[model samples]
Target: MHGWRIPASVWKWLILLMAGGLAVLVASELHVGLGARLPDGEGSLRVTLEDQLGARPQGLGTHWLTVAALDPRSPLAAAGVRPGERLRFDRPLDRWRRFAPGERVDVTLDSGRSLRLTALPTPVGLADRTDYIGRTLIVFPALLFTLAIGWHQPAQRAYRSLSMMFLAMSAAFFYSFWFGAADGPSALGKLVQLPLNCLAWYFAADFALHYAAQHTGHLRHWLAHAMRFYRPLALASAAYTAWFALGHEAPWLWVPSTLSIGGGALILFLSLVDGWRSGRGDLRQRYRWLVLGLMCGGVPPLLTMLPWLDWETGLGRITVLAYFGGQFLTYCLLGYAVMRYRVFDFYLAVNRVVVFGVVSLLLLCTFGMLQHWVAHHVSAGHSGFGWQLLSDAAPAVLVFLVFNKLHARVEHAVHAVVFRRWAAREAQLREWLAAIVHIRSSDTLVAGLAAALDRFGDHAGSAVYLRLPDGGFALAASATGRFPPRIGPNDPLAVLLRADLAPTRHQLPQDAGVLALPMCHRAQLHGIVLLGARPNGESWRPDEITLLADTASQAGLGLQALRVDELQQAVGSLHAQVRRRSVELQAAAGRRRFGMDALP
Candidate 1:
């Protein structure tokens, strides 16, 4: 039923009503039906005595008893009276002789059965009180906690956890009612109890699974399987308990149910404790508190089972009230945990809390004042001007304070965690660009350039191919990879060069990579520099584009200077070799003429 497709908020109210009903039922059975039985005040008392007893005992004094309302056929009925036998009074007291309302009396029956009943002025006691407590504070808060956690998380896990907890609590309350009224440890009792144990088991196990998956050191595959085994085992135990209780001896009926419920509960507690200890940060602290709340919540039910701990006639009612208190505390803690941990980004919780808290307070106050005014004249009742002013102003103030704090916190956290990394990467890029600018030799320059481009495959491979005086292009410098083969007069780059335009960034045709800059020098078009795409396929950012342009300009100047210096050195060396050879040839000719005269 908890799994049915209803709004969580609606389910919350429903659960509250059901829990209250269960508490009331339990109180009625234990206090009025089991412990005391009083005469009906107005309608049935006179007729019931006339029909059942036939003739009343003589000189019998009238006694009054006020009994709480209860189901007719319950364990207490079986304990004191035989099936189908009616209680017979010793004397029939006249209806007008009855005690005043809100009075208690003990009545003696002819069959020696004595009954005591206390008057209920408003049919609202411990059971109703528990119901109100759970509805207003516990169930509603639990729903809020679920919404806070589920708002931005993976839906499946959140849904499972919420359903499990809701159903578990529901089943537990339902079973508590049965345990009080069931006769002779009936088979039906066992069947009813199974659902409760199974729900509780699955809820705890699923919660642990979800929590563990988010943190480090998760259960291994086999261990996870074992953990999952808890659900079915608990369910099976419930089934077995039901089957055995139907036919087995009374003492043995509750064994399986007790084991399953106790075992699952113990394991869940251990898991919560372990998780809280190992976890870190504010999230962990919040979780620890939540776990503590859960553990505390189990105490009331456990106490109810202990005979020594229970008080007299209203023990069942007191036990239920205590349980409701635990539930309230647990739900509040869970909501707090969700908000503190940023489970779904606490913004939504903050907004809802601010809005609802202000609205409800104002509305309730106004309604109370209006109700009094309706009974008496407006002049005799309290003024609602203060209520109206608060309702109008509180929401606005809450919105302003909440949003302002949220914005500041989000900004600080983002700047600290995300943007600082980006800044560091940018600094590294600048250092690389600086190195490229200073390098002189063509080979060294290419290697450095290659290293820099490797950081972003923004340029796969590039080369500085200068247009020579003969109109052919020469490879001046190159990075590691193969150069583009088509580098000639007919190429598109040559056409751009002949047109004599300033340097610009261009993309090649048909995925033909990118060119960051067309090298130019001394007001003349020098050559084309080719670049390729980065691995991530991201376009260069504006700062990166500017850096690329600067690097290209510096490289062009270095290439021009190096080329001119080498050419001048070559010419001077050639002149020296030619002059020395000519002097040698003249000396050889003079020696030959002197040899001819000596021969004559």
Candidate 2:
């Protein structure tokens, strides 16, 4: 039997199926691993509240805290502790020196209800400091990458969608780092984290589906089609999760988060696998790199989701390092893929992002360290507000000056490294064309054209010869050397150029030589360009020849336009003269009529 050929569209489903299987397998392993690692239920009770326990300001203070919920089976619940009921202590809860587990606590609710219960250990832990650090490292680069892609390749729908996904993830990470700290109020932290958590997974899946459909051309597949609804679904899920967290104080929001995360991962996996299987040569290689990148950056972060892994655990630190390091490597690999394949023309953008990010980060860190040292070691007395302002401004001003000086150099280096030679040639062509459009004077236009050609470095000498009204080609502009004053209409080279209306090589007497490019618009020969040997003394490449021909055509059009404008001006002047003559004749006729009438 011959090898089977899968249609490109089928890859989407295949990837999804495979990804689902892989997710299931991973989830099962994680479940087993977590079960083995998690301690038996500590003396804590899980609870959901029907309504939020509102906070009230203490006497002469703005600080707020509340018994937000109560476990249904807990000792407090047996004593009539309920949601939305404010706790009243005999002395302020804050005033209590210490309360150990099993200590009796008594409180009256706002509704005059009374309760007495034993204190119990709550299943809460301090947020790890390393978690914040790792998240910052991951998110800063991700944000920069997203911004670069969005800014540079907005037209590419896939990239835009991917950027949004990254933005969502970054926001989630930021929220976790900022609000999920141990010092933050537990109820408020959970409220802020809920929607962001949902959004992160939703956008991740959404990005995967979009990536698959766009890059793999798998939109026709049913799964890809179904993914069309994923965005709306994700939004609804996030909204619901937020509402539930705020209103009911429920932990069930994890259901939607899990579904989104699992679905997205599955789709991404399927898409990648399908792309690798179906792609040919360079495309296949690109998919391989992308897969490796995703695995490196993506897997470690996912592993951190295991309930058993806290920041204090050795495995947690390993996962954090892996996550950050993997993501950095992934971005590098993706940037390489972009450069090699010209994906969304992102090479220059990637270079700019990397340079700016690294430089800015270094500058900020150095300034921070210096400020800290100065604050502790240099400042001996209390500095006033003005002095403080100066201290802050100094570092900012220094950084700005240093960045301004280095930015141009960095940009130049980046362009030189990232852009190909042809891109430079194209840029030169555009400059020449722009000059031709903007310069209206015939002399200036011709001079700029010759200068532009010389700057291209393809020719040692160049000249523009425009057709004069006297039926001869007059030298309008010359670069680097003198040229003949005029060429007769019947000259052999001129005849050939005019007839062909194209570039042609001509040999002059005395072994002097040139390439003649006819400048023609609408079959009318406007001018000719006589180009000398290349600066390198080599024959012109085909692309260079094409460039010359195109430029010559444009020059011809510019000449034609100039001639048209001159003719219009002359015609206007002639019309003005004719009007004056007609007025004078009419005045004389009136005088003659008046004289004839008087004589009679």
Candidate 3:
């Protein structure tokens, strides 16, 4: 992007599209299939997933089911099930996937009692659906963003690595969502998922290492050394996951994952520090955005997934959603990064997504949390129907009322604070535009433009070329440095301005360190604004250039308005002089016709 062009690969795009479609299909099946008649285990059961109760029996491979509500209609209740009681069968629950409809299964209770129960699939509830939706929301953006990067910069090695890393991370989340065990023939892919999880951490760390190593010089040598073992470590971790899947008790599974993530985190932190310390301008800003996104996206999962935290304490299904909320924030940050880095020429798309996506996510997330909190205080079983309905709808109602206002504030914050330089300048330009309308003098217009140009540019020396009556321009106002006193109508600058009103490099003396922005209204060229180079020696970005050109457009319109005002004033003065002369002639003629009056 700095100089060379990266061509998009057609085959890569087709593959990405196919993969995205498959993902959508899989997610839809998982979501819609819930509570539907299971072809194999043709039954239904309602229970919240909770931790194992007491200890597993010596013969009962692992605890299968727990946490049953006292629903008399449930198949489990017919087996005399109680809350917090462990339910298992003659075999593991994973093997019960093939039971026919109405097939009898024997269950062993925690009290050493045997009861016959029918095989049942888990029931889908609102909470379940919410959790499922939230998880989808979490990983969806990663795939989309990965696809975007692949489409935009597939040729870049760093970007390709970045896309792969994001894809792996999303895959890991897909397997880990709901935190359920692989308990069915349908879930046989969980064996592959274990290895995928480990790959996620490895790829994340490796990508971060490479990205930082390339950008920050201090970390290059160590990062290169780490890269030497990158493939080996990744293969080793995958092998360990396979061993774990094969019923081997390998505690070392986490060791490699931890080492990879830890290394990556360390590299990102150091790169951030080094960048802010030594880097300048846009490069430093990019490092800041990337680091911020990592912290925001990665830190919360660590907190939420902590062992000590009692997830059973009213956080049951919501904890999963909490994870979704955090991941979405990370996506927002990534959106900003992609735009800021110019990875794609789609800033407007990303901007709307960042601004509106953050707001909508927060709105829905708040609604979900409020609903969860209200349900905790007023028990659904005990509360009146009206009270229950009111409680359930309150969160939605609240968010609905404030949505417009919230979106406004979020948009304002994005423009005024987060994207200060890029968007805030537009607001300032409007103020300049307001001033330009009332003042009719060309000097005032020139002075206002020069000031605006200097203020928006980084310590810039800005000057405005005043348009003359004979279709020439003269240097009228300079906010900082000098320029050519006068420009001929036949000069190349005038010809370019008249033909097309776009900014071009100023090469008056060759290496003048200036940009020439033409001011035009309608089809008429009015003037030109000269913008100096930044003190940091970095050129203005494309977006910034566009903004300045917009400012020039405003200046041109203002100039046109001033010309119209001057012409009106001149016409009024001519009319007044004509009336006065006509009146004097009429008085002289009357005096001549009256003879005495003429003598007088």
Best TM-score goes to which candidate?
3
Q: What's model 2's lDDT at 448?
A: 82
Better of 1 and 2 by TM-score: 2
Worst 10 residues of 2 by lDDT: 51-60
lDDT of each: 0.47, 0.56, 0.60
lDDT of 1 by residue, 57-173 (tens): 221112222222333443223345433343422222222122223444344544567765433323223443334324334433443343333442323453446444654454443
- Candidates 1 and 2 compared by lDDT, better number: 2
Better of 1 and 3 by lDDT: 3
What's model 2's overall lDDT?
A: 0.56
List model 2 lDDT by residue over 1-600, tens digit each.
001343323433433343343333323322322222111111232333222111111211211124567667777577666565555444232211122344465555666676665656542232333444445445555556666655555544455555555555454343332321122232243344457555655545555454545446453265576566765666767786666544333344455555665666766677767777766434566567667766676676576565344344542355555566776676656654555443334554475565556446544545554554454335435589866666567667776877666656755654566555646877987777967777667677788888777667454688888888866798888887566768788888777877777777644422224567888877978787877766554444345667878987887788778868878988999999999999999999999999999994
RMSD (Cα, Å) for all candidates, in order, is 19.7, 19.4, 10.3
Over all chains combined, what TM-score does candidate 2 have? 0.43
The superposed Cα distance between candidate 1 and the true structure at residue 238, in angstroms, equals 4.2
Q: For model 2, state the Cα shift of residue 358 in Å.
A: 6.5
The backbone clash count of each candidate, in order, is 3, 1, 1
> At residue 170, what lDDT does model 2 achieve?
51
Which parts of model 1 have CA positions greater than 4 angstroms off?
Answer: 1-137, 143-154, 170-194, 214-229, 238-253, 312-318, 343-347, 350-600
Sort order, TM-score high to low = 3, 2, 1
Q: Cα RMSD (Å) between model 2 and the true structure?
A: 19.4
Residue ranges of candidate 3 with Cα displaced over 4 Å: 1-7, 18-22, 29-134, 177-192, 206-215, 239-251, 302-312, 316-325, 336-346, 353-442, 454-541, 550-600
lDDT of 1 at 102: 43
- Highest lDDT, which number? 3
